[model samples]
Target: MNTPYKNAKLHDCRDAFTATLEALAGQNSDIVAVCNDSVGSSKLGNFREQFPERLINVGIAEQNMVGVGAGLANGGKIPFVCAAAPFLTGRALEQIKADVAYSQTNVKLVGISSGMAYGELGPTHHSIEDFAWIRALPNVPVIAPADRAETAAAIRWAAQYEGGCFLRLSRVGVPDLLPDDHVFELGKANMLRDGHDVTLIANGVLTHRAMIAAALLEARGISARVLNMASVRPIDEAAIIDAAHATGAIVTCEEHTIFGGLGSAVAEVVVDHAPVPMTRLGVPGVFAHTASANTLLDDFGMAPDAIAQSAEALIGRKG
Candidate 1:
């Protein structure tokens, strides 16, 4: 099985985001980067150097950072708010709701180092609850790109889109899960690998893991379909239901909590249309202890091998 590291050129999605944002900013002067003293972590140093005046740093106050982003958007500026995922989503949730979503502001909320990217920093730094928090908002579209290619595409699309949206960026390095030129489609799920035994759905860092799981399943004479579902809010219901009907079983994995993340989103579609046996792999439901991101994934049964085993178990339950 080809792992993420097997590819010669490995890239963190955050780099792609910053590069795309800077390039877009050159084309449109309205593009701006708003952060809470996270210029280095968010890879906005180049952006700041290029357009120092356009980079707005709010000095670690996540709430005020989000509010300022909203205000910037109201003033005809395309604000790309960048900060740690945990604080950006948890602390500034009210501003995100009232200033961005409720007010229909065209702000691009960029959550860097999201989904346990700062694993050694403990649960306080983890952003497992981001999916649930952002998905609940009415007008905001929650997106977690599967690879650097998808990340760049999503960034371009977000720049062109005229509405409030959240781009969940991770510092974790991921291999190319989608084609090099994959286009970003809102509310659409990309089918990566095709099979009939069981379906494996994932996004972000977990998408490559799901592909590895499918390879493991194939070795054991099991054919598993793989879906790279980047868009969490307007989920692809038709693709999900097709997988349920064809495979009869599904296994979903993500870097977020299983409660209201990708798994929960898939289960919602399955239970509504084509109910099937399924397994959701993620950070169970508890705050994660101090560990590296990969270690945390292994501890939570989301490692490639564990994901394969979970898919095998689900196949047994398939009718």
Candidate 2:
């Protein structure tokens, strides 16, 4: 299946995130926004203006911010902890494990500017390892919304869901992938296009690229299926197996490192159920040099053309 979504108007997922959050906060006073001096980045200024007291700015302390979120959850208040992805996962991994995951608190851990959205800032600011870090812990459903619609839907879902969850969002603009009435279903994959020759799976900013890659594959006389996989932790194993069995080959892409990100998660499911020729496209276990997000993606062979080429190669290995 090939769709012309790349040319659609782009949207920043954070806008949808804040708008949905503010609307939800209006109905539920228990909702709160917790951040580490990231009001501007997280787009929580409007949220702060609407509900000043409910917005908790912990200021520079990532660990303390997460701990505070856990405390708020304990006090019967729903806390949406927001911060840069690297600091959120790298700096507060212990607190996330002890106060949230282990305690099973009803806190929404929102990792803003995830993946290479902070591109050009340098590798230290990049959050390529967040998926690996957060997914290693149990009881936390890791998710990355593909577009603004999905972001808002996921935020709404997180508000209603109990316990803890990691909502990985990016500042990069993406065209609307899912429909406006799209409802988020955890552990379920959205089939953007149906094909039987091969499967192209991706999440976050890479999803649009995957769609474009599917189009490119179609131009070359290949039937490429496209899947937008948002939930990384509780991935759609059934869809993965079906794709593997039907397609006989797979190409997985992500904005995170290939070592333990979306590609790795899908590959795990494929090997266990229906082993097939697979190619994982991402930062191949190396700290990326300073460059724009799109440049880095192309450099790592995650650009649409590169992805399409890799899919063709993977399909060649199919027996």
TM-score of each: 0.97, 0.98
| Model 2 score (lDDT) | 0.93
Q: What C-alpha lDDT does candidate 1 achieve relative to the native structure?
A: 0.92
Q: How far off is model 2, as Cα RMSD?
A: 1.6
Q: Rate the local accuracy (lDDT) of all candidates.
A: 0.92, 0.93
Can you write out model 1's per-residue Cα lDDT over 126-159, one digit (the tens) per residue? 9999999999889999999989999999999999
TM-score of 1: 0.97
Candidate closest to the true structure, highest lDDT: 2
Write the residue-wise lDDT of candidate 2 on 1-319 in tens digits: 2247645788999999999999999999999999999999999999999999999998999999999999999999999999988999999999999999899999899999988888899788899999998899998999999999999999999999998999999998899889998999999999999999999999999999998998888999999999999999999999999999999999999998889888889989988899999999999999998889878898899878899999999988988
> Candidate 2, residue 36: CA error in Å?
0.6
Candidate 2: 10-residue stretch with minimal lDDT: 1-10
